[model samples]
Target: MKLQGTMLVKENELYIGGVSCKELREKYQTPLYVFDEDLVRNNCREYVKHFRVNKENNRVAYAGKAFLPIYMCKLINEEGLCLDVVSGGELYTAYKAQFPMEKILFHGNNKTIEEIKMGVELGVGRFVVDNYYELELLEKICEEKGEKQAVYFRITPGIEAHTHEYIKTGQIDSKFGFTLSNGELYNALEKLNNYKNIELVGIHAHIGSQIFEVEPYLDEVKIMMNLVKEIKESYNIDIKEVDLGGGMGVYYTEEDKPKTIKKFCEAIIEKTEEVCKKIDIKVPILIIEPGRSIVANGGSTIYTVGAMKHIKGIRTYVSVDGGMTDNIRPSLYQAGYECAIANKIGEKRKNQVTISGKCCESGDILITDTNIMDIKSGDILIISSTGAYGYSMASNYNKITKPAVVSVQNGKSKLICKRQSYEDLFKLEVV
Candidate 1:
């Protein structure tokens, strides 16, 4: 993976914005997540620049599930990007960050009544309604509260993109959206049109995550355009927007090649304009919810080597202080990652080993079969391209406290999140 912007490796040490990784590890201790603030801002600018060049009424909504904290919300808000929250906790985090309610887009498959009511009360920018039950609950809440809610119908375009099955969400048989094979989508649109409180303003579709190709999005736009035509013809509903949910892939390994965000956006705009022209409908506003693509490559995880074990004719096990508790991607999706010893960055590859975490389970492996150079106890290992789901999916597994997070920019580093303490784990426990 290409390490761009302020995050770089210098003199056998990782550096972010002129600050060395060794310095960060020293201050924050091992098992740390360090984000390059300048890199993230640059990424945001790249997206906005491309969208502006296309002259599309576009909104870059930061997908908060990747890594969300009150500080992140503020950073995204400062960059002028909207927020896409999937659960009540995410929404609350945005709220705590004092993010503008008008720029928040609520999304989820199964939203509880309280969540629906919360959205209604907060007057969110839009709600991406996933199922019939959620639609019903939204209508009920809006009706009782005498409010008009802007909603987008989430549809399964059935275009299966090449990605992990556990992360794929856009297939026909998936649990997320209204399937296209059945008339369920049409029926739901009809029902939504008749509802007094619901205003169906757009259509939303997400093919999958970690997608590298453009064909899936091209296919999705076609399906959504057809649905838009049907909705206009049947109900005379003038859809104002079409959200092609974000799944643009980023480089995780040497073999993975992903298109630039600018190129991806241009393709989407071209296809959307073509489809809308063909259907004789106005081009709707384009919204993207990019989570990993924006931030995944902008951060890295730092861990201190705890032990090293060599087995003859088998493999060497290099263990770190943190395991699945800090990063669940490997365990969840069998995700592949690349790492370099922070203290020995320029050394030649002298050993082949598997990086293991300090956890009880056998499955708590971080990287399997990785090439290393002179790994030893007390060396610092830095995992790259972990900015997305690493810290967000962290747990207190085996009662291991989560690590601290620091944002580096312009030769300076500031702590954004504090390391979890042992007392934090027992605070919620009952006697």
Candidate 2:
């Protein structure tokens, strides 16, 4: 397995951020989400540094849907990065963290009325409006409050980006934004002209997540520029923001080859400048909301081996103390992960096994046909590239308690998210 972030070999044991994984397993217990603070913060800086083609107009907004706890929100706030929140819970987290309300961009397909009211009251920076219902609802709320809410019309560019079906949002048939081919895009823009309380300042489009290609982003920029010209000609408007919503894939395993942030920024800036010069349109605020690419590789999950099951003429099953409850990517979208025995890193690599979770369901396998060192009970297994959706999408399947999270830096560990207790599972329940 790849050594990520501060991971290093000390005395033949895996150490992340100066904290030994084996020792961490003994202290925090198995199924722990460990993040290197220095690494995560560095990623934030890297994104901000590379994506800043135009300092006046460009800003990198950290997509909170990837991983949002109060601690993460505070970290993003400290890094001077804008935030993209998709739901009320995320917004609340940001609120509690005292994040700058003016730097928060509200995003969701079906935002609740309460959420809209809260955004309007708190002065959120922008709203990436999805459909007609939400657009009208937000207009009415802003009108009632005697305020003008800035918004960006999310348009589906009919680009079939190569990615999983569940995550591809920019396609023509998707339920997300208004489709350009269906006349809804023009209609939405036409209606926005009359929305007195709404300020249409930009356009946003996201192709998909975990994407490994640069062409798709280039294609998206071209399409957005063309649309921008058409809107300017038809509606006689000047869009100040062109938010090509972020969905750059990260390295999950050796098989996955993702572009560096530098390369990605180069491709995006080159294409954007070329298109803008050709169309004679001034470059607007170039916004990209990267979530996974920023946080995925900087975090990892540590699990304890519990049981090993083997069948004649079949595969070997190595069960860990945690499974779908902690990291459900494998079960959710057939997501792949690479893991290694943290306790015994240099052991012989003669064994091939399938890693299973402690969940009762048979479909709770974490990895299959994976080659790793021999595993035994009481060994710590480190799963890499789980920083994005692992803890954010965790569940209480089979009453399993969610694991705790720790941010490690310079060999010291600080608890960010406390482990859920049994009472937490029933905190919202009644006898």
Candidate 3:
């Protein structure tokens, strides 16, 4: 419904990066993932501007879990943003891309020992320690490696960020981090002192994902600041950085009004500075791991219309070749999206249709009850804002092959990820 990034409708045809969507569909085939290079770069630039500071004390790590490929990692490195990785694959992608190891921060709740080994071996900058086990394990690994690793203890601030229940991380009962309300946070910090190899530089807190309000983040800052002040009074140690995990919501539908990045950044910086001033503590390096907001709306999924089913007085079902295998956010988080007939844009919109993925599961719907122009077989259906987790979380469900990913910039396009062939579905399988 809304044109974003390089998206424009010329002569009623949807064009992204000055390239035609129909052309992309023809060249790359349907169920394609399209990322706008300039948009991603612009998002990085805009996010950097608002969150900018001297390189020594401030940084923005693009959460690579959103949509990570070697090329995109290269883009992130080129754009001068740090990379936040949560798994070995993500970290390995960064490593293989020759991403500056000093700019990578590792995170995960249940990171395998091998993953930890890989990160430490690759000289990752820091690890957002999730639990005591990871802290102890990482410390031992660092000791074994004869190296010092900086770390930030993840603190659960017990704030229920108003978002989907599945995505909330800062709540007290979450499986993420040490709960601030409990004594374990202090215990964890106190225990950290014994690990000589771990230099606990700061604390990290992520209230939740897909969050829209700034007040929650402001609350988180104040809460974390209070904790930092108390830690200072109790332990006489200073926190040098505070990584607020990114969850700035973006436009998924017309009714979703996400806060502007500028306003959000301003509020965060002003509040952090204000709190630091009030607490008489130095403003630490503020880190935000933005994944969805930075890349979500900058990408779209192109699917071809197949069969149409209309239940009398119910809804029209337009099946696309791709579904739950490519993008599962709709079913996983009840996510919403806006789609249009890429080849038939600028036409009179008279039909309301529900888009269905070809997945065998009944819950494999993409857009529910959307209004599109007349749809027909072979029509290109361009779904918006799928850059974040579409490809990253894709699967081979029903043995459906995954689509290729293309990055478009300045009317030029380049393939970033190759489509999975049927062989890819069972490449690693053994009889």
Candidate 4:
């Protein structure tokens, strides 16, 4: 198994963040999401440290959709990174975290009036305008509030990133942003000219998520910079901020090879500088919203193995207590993950088994056809790189309760999210 974020095997046991996984399983119970706090902090610091062209002009915003608990929000706030929230709930999370209001970047494709009003009332720093409706609606809201709002036009650059089809956002046909090839962006700009309450302060574009290549980002920078120049030349509008929304990938299995954070930062910074220098325009406030890369490898989900069914001459189904209830990635994206027997790390891999979850659906497989040590009921199974969308996309299928989340650091562990109880599921149901 590929170990990450302070993971090491000591005395034939797997340990993460200096805490033994066996102990974590015994204390926190199985089907638990464990994040290395030190690793998360270090990822934040790396982005803050290396992603710079001008110290004052660059910002790193943690995309909260990946995996956000209140504790995660507080950790991000303390790490000096900005927050990018897509909905009112995330905005509220940041607000509850007491994150600096001015450091928040609000983004969404179809932001509702209530959400826009919430951001406006809370005094968020930047609103990434997605479509014409939002553009006009935001102006109306600002006019009603008698306040001026700064926004970035999220333009689709038509770059097809190499990723799953569902995740590609920068294509011309995507629902995310105004397409650059079409006249929609120009029309939006013309509309912006008539709005007095809204200020078009920047431009934003996100190609896709879980991207492994840096060339796509360079392509994104080139196209966006050209748009900045055209807007400057045609409309004399100076876009002072440029947000290339983040999709940096992380290692999941042996087949996955992602770029280092420093390399990604260096490549992006160099490309932006080159384009700015070529266009003879000063670099705008460059921002990136990294979600998965910051948290993915730092997290591991530990589950207690149970109920082994051997299909003779075919495969073995090793069941775990958790499934789509706590992690839905494998079912959703056909995502592959590396796993190991936490307590039997040193054992020889002799069994090829499919890790099945407790969910009723047969699609609830977590890791399929993977080799691991011969395992019995009650052995611990640790899946790596589950920190990103595992819990964030979790569901209560079969009405199963969600698992708890804990962060480990320096041989210490703290619960970040409490496990849902049977009663918690019916908390909102009408009696």
Q: What ranges in model 4 sit over 4 Å off?
A: 53-56
lDDT of each: 0.87, 0.90, 0.90, 0.91
Per-residue lDDT over 328-423 for candidate 2, one digit per residue giving the tens place of the 0 to 100 score:
899989999999999888777788999999899999999998999978888889999899998999999899999999988998999999999999
Collision count of model 2: 0
Q: Residue 184 error for model 4, in Å?
A: 0.6
TM-score for each predicted model, relative to the true structure: 0.97, 0.98, 0.98, 0.98
Clashes of each: 0, 0, 0, 0
Quality of model 3 by C-alpha lDDT: 0.90
Q: What is the C-alpha RMSD of each candidate to the true structure, in Å?
A: 1.3, 1.1, 1.2, 1.1
| Predicted candidate 4 versus true structure: per-residue lDDT over 1-431, tens digit per residue | 98787998998899998889889988988789999998899999999999863376599999999988889998998888999999999999888888888999999999999999999999999999999899789989999999999999999999999999888898998988898887889988887778999988899999999999999999999998888999999888999889999999889988778999999999998998899999898888889999999999889999998899999999999999998778888888898899999998998999899999988898989999999998999999999999998888888878888889999988889998998889999989998
What's the lDDT for candidate 4?
Answer: 0.91
Ten-residue stretch with the least lDDT total in model 1: 48-57
lDDT of 3 at 64: 92
Candidate 2 differs from the real structure by a C-alpha RMSD in angstroms, to one decimal, of 1.1
Q: Write candidate 1's Cα lDDT for 397-417 as tens digits.
A: 888999999998888889889
Q: Find the 10 residues in a row with the least total lDDT in model 2.
A: 48-57
